[model samples]
Target: MSNNVLKNLKPYEVFKYFEEITQIPRGSGNEKGISDYLVAFAKEHNLEVIQDEALNVIIKKPGTAGYEGAPTIVLQGHMDMVNEKNQGTEHDFDKDPLKLRVEGDMLYATGTTLGADNGIAMAYAMALLASKDIAHPPVEALMTTDEEAGMSGAMALNPEHINGRILINIDSEEEGKLLVSCAGGVRVSVTLPIKWEDIKEDKTPIVIRLRGLKGGHSGMEIHKGRGNSNKIMGRILYDLQDRVSYNLCSLNGGAKNNAIPREADAVLLVNKEDVEGLKAVASSWNEVLKNELKASDPDVNVQVEVLPDRYNKMFSKETTKKAVQLLYLIPSGIQTMSMEIAGLVQSSTNLGVVTTSKDMITYDSATRSSVKTLKEDLVNQFKLLAEVVGVECETRADYPDWQYDADSKIRRVFERVYKEMTGNDPEIVAIHAGVECGLFKEKFGEMDMISFGPNLYDVHTPDEHISISSTERMWNYLIAVLKEIK
Candidate 1:
């Protein structure tokens, strides 16, 4: 903890609270200690605290002496974070504290995610809890869990637990922006069965890996034109198999459902006589890919290594042909860009995870769209694609889109405050990525919501960093809005 509370309390002080939080591991669906810490903080501060069965915490601060009759406002944000690290990061997200570092005006963690997405919101909450000088209306600070993996905690919020109808979700990544809408999303899994056969063609088994792609959040960075490892590996196989007779053994890629796959590996048995032809085919495809996505994915790489293996069996010829054809044809990148918002993505799909087994293989992907009807149409399109490929398709955990509220009162207040603080109007926009605001609005009817935050870059990845200067600007805006809100 810092020595001073309010003296010279800039935005980085809020970030200091975030640095301390990084010491505690609070991954999705596992937020016991963090929850306890929050309750204890509320108790120590003499705030009214309520803990729900869903493990959601709401700490209420009664309105300032003069603003008692104003509407109660909810300051909402999630508590849990996505635990991710780089290829060689030694820090354990479960036990070790996040190593925070400062470079210029950016705050980042060493070799791991900094968890500033919601940690910033948590710090803002702590600042509010510690503040006795600021005059504000009745405020409810809601810290939820399991937001990174899913909106389970937000979905479980009891609408009647608090009397706050206006909510400000401090979870967005961009500063000087008001996020009034967000896309709805769901996960789809396609499973295909495979039959094994003996490798009778005197073939050599080789382990091939396609790695070093700059992976990012599937929803946020889909239009950045980065290469998907799953698609890259499939393309390599598709081209190589045409030049050399090969039997595929196994294919696996990616770890999470929301991340664009960064690496993929495949084992294949190829005849020794056709090795030269296979090499040439791979070279041609690599050149083609490098030329095609040079601007977006400059570091994309594909490598192969021969392995000594007595292959009992490989995928049956018929099954292998079907699998390869299906995987190669499935769309794994941005589908459409929004005509309404310049540089905004409307409909997109991500081929996130793939795994192969003896009997069957499973590939998981996600789709997102802010337009409800368009989302349904895209899901139907995916179902049709799966049917054509002879695979069983299923979708789960569907969440509704947070429709844009152009006339939202909360947005008006935020816009006025932002203008007053910076002498310029903030950008009021909608995000293509899904936010918990949609889930909360779905569970609780007619809740006015707006989301804003400091600038954060490359979240859910090892290169994540928070802009300290932007955090200061956002903090000033937040304070100004609190002072003006009725």
Candidate 2:
């Protein structure tokens, strides 16, 4: 094959396919175009492909030469990427392709995510689909959907649709590691009523905006000492209330529960006289937080800007006090570290999203862990907190955790294969975040599974990038294992 056929093909030819797929918009819940593209590519290669009702596409490649009798293996990954961006970026994920750039050995986007989490897996599958010379057993490519959000497609998967007993999930972020277990997750939302009172006293609209925090994965980065904007904003408001009389008008921060809140904004109607004092307080708090979170979030910015107009109907005194109290009392960040796995977080919660409307102010929180009892216990803790704060709590989309299976045959096979290939033992660990493996295991009981992937750093953030050399090594390792399996 000519090198020109693979335009940006570096050490790993699969990255070229990944680059092509990056040009197409494959955000969660909007994967029709990408799914169609995959189907077309499969048909062009004369491969047998099936598109299920859920838009899941499966392409099957027959065994190569004398390896026909070898057991089949299913290669799985999601087709969608999380649409997240930085504070002041003007990139549209739907219409524009990912602006990929290479710095040193890392491949990243200009102002958006590089989409290598599953894009690499999709590329690897495509490479397997297109390759004819590589010797391997029967191959089945299962491209799932909506994995970043809630594992909607995986949960919806019918076990009767797939035939492979062994599945290799290529979604782990780190390299040289095998993941056999992952945490479950649940999103809890608290809605509180607003009591707006007409302000007899004149007040100015002062915006307290929290930005420049290095927000990261709520699960993996929770113990890394980064500050949550939602929590910090609550602390600021709680302290400001003691010093000055302010009305909470509007507050907004964060979008997804799995990501730490980077930027938050609150428009508060404060007494005109206290503007200078509030600004001074904000500056002092910024300095304090900068010193505290510099190890994790170096650019912690907290600014208070004065606005010209006041809120149409400011909050009554009673409502303002209660709202600030609730914000201070909400539980966020890592609650407890795991006892089973040393240095692993067992339970954590994030106050990710906060929004204000004319009628009410609502805050969204998500709690996650590998232990089911601990996860539920955290939810109940939040419920009690909300009750004392006088807010209605609601839970949604609870997913099962993939408990660690010590006797899994797939893990043993991967460990042996990795040790033989690299001459060093790979790290085996259980993650605190949720993966589709849990849902798949629930559906297909007794299915042998393990997840591994190339080195992907800063996932779900604008800083997200993947290593080209690591990807090449990963491909070689996977091919070696696939050929070794009988």
Predictions in order: lDDT: 0.82, 0.84
Clashes of each: 0, 1
Error of 1 at 193 (Å): 0.8
lDDT (tens digit, per residue) of candidate 1 on 314-422: 9987777777776787667777776666677877788899999768888888888877787788778778988987788889989988877767898999988778777
Residue pairs with clashing backbones, model 1? none
RMSD of each: 4.0, 4.8
